[model samples]
Target: MEPFKVHILGCGSAVPTNHHRPSSQVVEVRGKFFMVDCGEGTQLNLRNCRVSFSKLQAVFISHMHGDHCFGLLGMISTFGLTGRTTPLHVYAPADYATLFERQMDYFCKRRDFEVVFHPVDTTRHMVIFEDRSLRVESIPLEHRLPCCGYLFREQPSLPHIRRDMIDFYHIPICYINNIKNGAGWETPEGEKVPHERLVTPAAPPRSYAYCSDTRYIPTLHELLKDVSTLYHESTYTSHEADKAALYYHSTGEQAAQVAKAANVGKLLLGHYSARYHEENQLLKEAKSIFPNVYLTDEGMVFDV
Candidate 1:
């Protein structure tokens, strides 16, 4: 429960507008930050939002699109200049490995920290990253280029220890961890104290899904089933359905359908086209289909 949240850095499409930037967001799970899509000015956004640069563990790029990854080199260079020593992990399509290496060699020479690249398939659903408290999985998406989304799932925490039981039984502090791990305690009088009596069940884990720059792909529903919150691209309104299909992008209506199919707790609409001065039309269209849709704006934060 330690801030399972998303901070929207940018939410515009390919073209940058005075109002919105490209695609970028920071997902914080249990106090650790994972950046998704480092669009232009993402580092500046991070600084403006007061996110600690040293706490950013990794960056996940949805595709090779400039709108999604153009800021990566700049961010890396900035990190180098700031004298960061921790290794920075970047996950992107396998095809970007060569390009990334070339850019790093030319711009990031003799850096203090290492840039670790993790090549993603972009065509399969797999657990790409895991820690003690959370896991990140790649969710294949339909796009003009090879692209994928990311699913962040929080690992279930240990059950709450029963203070009354511990106090009554005089259980040693050292044995608390064992009890939390489902071990029963044996009393000195040869009595068995079951773990069930020492701890309560843990709360269910929560999950968030980020589906950016993808068309309406039905297959994605299965991967996103029952997610706590979903951030899906809504680059156009229902009126531009034809254009959306032609460009392999999603309309607001399509994004809502995906959220409805997946039965998510809430749907966040983002990646808006610059053409619209206001997102009311897109929000209206999506809400007509799925009532729980929310619009994304720069600097907006959502707790999941």
Candidate 2:
């Protein structure tokens, strides 16, 4: 079966440090790829991660900040240079449409592919994109400007077949699929087997939420319930929460508080400030509140 994965290409604040790049990530559902927050040099980061540009179905921008959207033109131009024909969809704030389109038209007018812009209202908490197996929703967040997070929810999967039950009942191969699809089996003597008995229940669906640059919003816990994994910006330590608030960012302790309140399975902290020599302080602060939290790194792949 295809796997769901999140590839972290960049995880730094506005200033790109030697240890980390700007905010960028590639989320892979099954085999389809979606880029989130394409900051400066995102195209190079994509190459560094060995992510094929051809597989990217769309790009999702969290806000209009330079650190969140500067690399979009280069990524689109590279797609054109590679001779791609399929349309590339970009979901971002409505105000970014005019400038983004103009830049693309000037730099990539000769390309064969089409760049489709989907304007997103940063204040809404509605589904922005959906396919057969996945749905992406915008998360309302508190920020200096219009900014929002994203939630990736996977659809429920089919239950597994019970081979032992089928063998015990002497069910033929033809009826095995029916059992998996919630159908019961009957022997030649007309003895019936219940659908619930033939197969175990499927696992619950998994969800992942990405919170970019934002201050702590107390009401976010209600919206983030049932999320399996949460990636929130932890731009400062607990002591500098005052500074974090002033800059519209979150401290490591604040991120952990959100994770604990939301009851998520795991929390991944990213978007660290360059002031910290290492992530030990950040990780310690978050782990003190939420034990299941982990610090994100460049080129890291997380399974959801």
Candidate 3:
């Protein structure tokens, strides 16, 4: 399976550090891109990662926090400067729509392309966007302000062709596609060749969930049952549990607990505080609970 690819642009918390910028990432699948969180310096990172703005179909903001969406206006202006004619969709909480439009009026006076805003409720778990191959859903979160994450799910592929079965039945080449689509073929003798004998079942559908800037919610795993990969914010370590709760953030351990509860294939940790020069302690703590966990850094790409 060609899984969804996530390119990490920035992973730092509210405060940017020498090693990290802010919270931002680009998700790609089947050559199409979707951005999650447009923090400061996201455009530069996009260029640095070789992910062209033309491939981005939409942007989903987790919240109105500066670290999460400060780069939206700047990116929009840059898109205009680069002569983008395709309409760009931006999804965020309903309250942020007015402020976003106001900012666009002041900063982006005239642009050829349309910048469409889609207001998300930030309180419901429902499908917000979908295409023939993929769908994105909202995951409500607990934060100081209204926020929601996104789940990208790929559609199941067609069954694989079986050369041996085709040869045995003397099937015509024109009928291969139909067989893969779960159709039954009749031989010259009028014997039925079932799809089960003509093709193998397809791989299970894959999914990736992006959750950041929220406190630990034990019930969140229920919404993430079939997700194979989870990019969760580990803003602090267990030692800073008090601070994490005060700021409505989760410790590394809490993130891992959520992953374990969901039974996900892998857990990706990011969104670190500025104070932590290294996240070794955070990685180790999460590993104690969920073994298949890794840290995501700027410019790194993960497929799941």
Candidate 4:
């Protein structure tokens, strides 16, 4: 089966203006919701986009920047108000634990659900979360403070058993697991049942890379190589490249370079600086280098 979808809720950067909010996205995989960055007004964006907060299982923060995490406390508080019982897991940088806990202390309302914090390793790339369907890894990026990006790799499914073969050969249900695991079965007569005859290879897995706020760091090439989709923060245009460098942010062209170098199948650029009224120039700049580059609009859902 194909993995779940990813939705871009709010894609503006800090300096939020009337037109844009901040950074926030919803990545749904295998029927679970994983939120990334909860800037101010994120919950509203989620509501407008018709996403259910109750289904959200995890939130991944890229850094301590308010634009990336300011709405977390509010969201959790609302969850408390709604009497949520399911535990919410938060994966973020180490600093976020202190900040989030302090905010929760201000509320002081005993949460009906548990909130577990899993800090991402900012010093190096690390696999912070994994399961049968997907794995999430953190890639440290060049920022004024400790910041990181995320890579979501979908795991290939187990080989599916050929039901027809089972019925034809009168195969026992006891050996189904072995066939799914690609192990040949042995009958009581010591006859070998080849795995290939019982099962078929699974579909290839899809992958997406989310490069949070960062400067034009070339090493990201290796970290994001050949992903199905890449979402990079293009906070500035080429004219503002100097300013982006000073602020440890990336320009549209630079974002495209990373995507091109990484050989990604598609590039979705967002996190635009509030300075620009329109992002036509930014999109044009990125498209020059990467043909598959696209400007991410709020509420746009990218089905991976």
Measured over all alpha carbons after superposition, the RMSD of each candidate to the real structure, in angstroms, is 1.2, 1.7, 1.3, 1.8
* Model 1 TM-score relative to the real fold: 0.97
* Per-model TM-score on C-alpha atoms: 0.97, 0.94, 0.97, 0.93
- Flag regions of model 1 displaced more than 4 Å: 188-191
lDDT for each residue of candidate 2 in 51-119, tens digit (9 for 90 to 100): 898889999999988888989888888888887899899999888889987888788889888788999
Write one digit per residue (lDDT tens) for candidate 4, span 1-304: 7556789988899887888888999998888778988999798898887878789989999988889988988889888888789999999888767866776778735888988889777877988999987899998898887899888888888988889988877878887887798787666688888889888888778888888899999788998888889999999999989999999999999999998999999999999998899999999999999988888888899977
TM-score between model 4 and native: 0.93
Per-residue C-alpha lDDT of model 1 across residues 157-201, encoded as one tens digit per residue:
999999999999999999899899989988889999888989999
- Residue 87 of model 3: what lDDT? 93
**Candidate 2 has what TM-score?**
0.94
Q: Write the per-residue lDDT of candidate 3 for residues 1-304, one digit (tens) a residue.
A: 6647999999999987899988999988777899999999889999999988777889999999999999989999999999899999999999998988899999997998998999999999999999988899999999999999999999888999999888988889998888887899998898987779888888888899999989999899999985989999999999999999999999999999999999999999999999899999999999999999999999899987
Flag clash pairs in model 4: none
**Per-residue lDDT value at 170 in model 2:** 84
Off by over 4 Å in 4: 185-193
* Model 3: residues with Cα > 4 Å off, grouped in runs: none
Candidate number that wins on lDDT, 1 or 2: 1
Give the C-alpha lDDT of model 1.
0.93
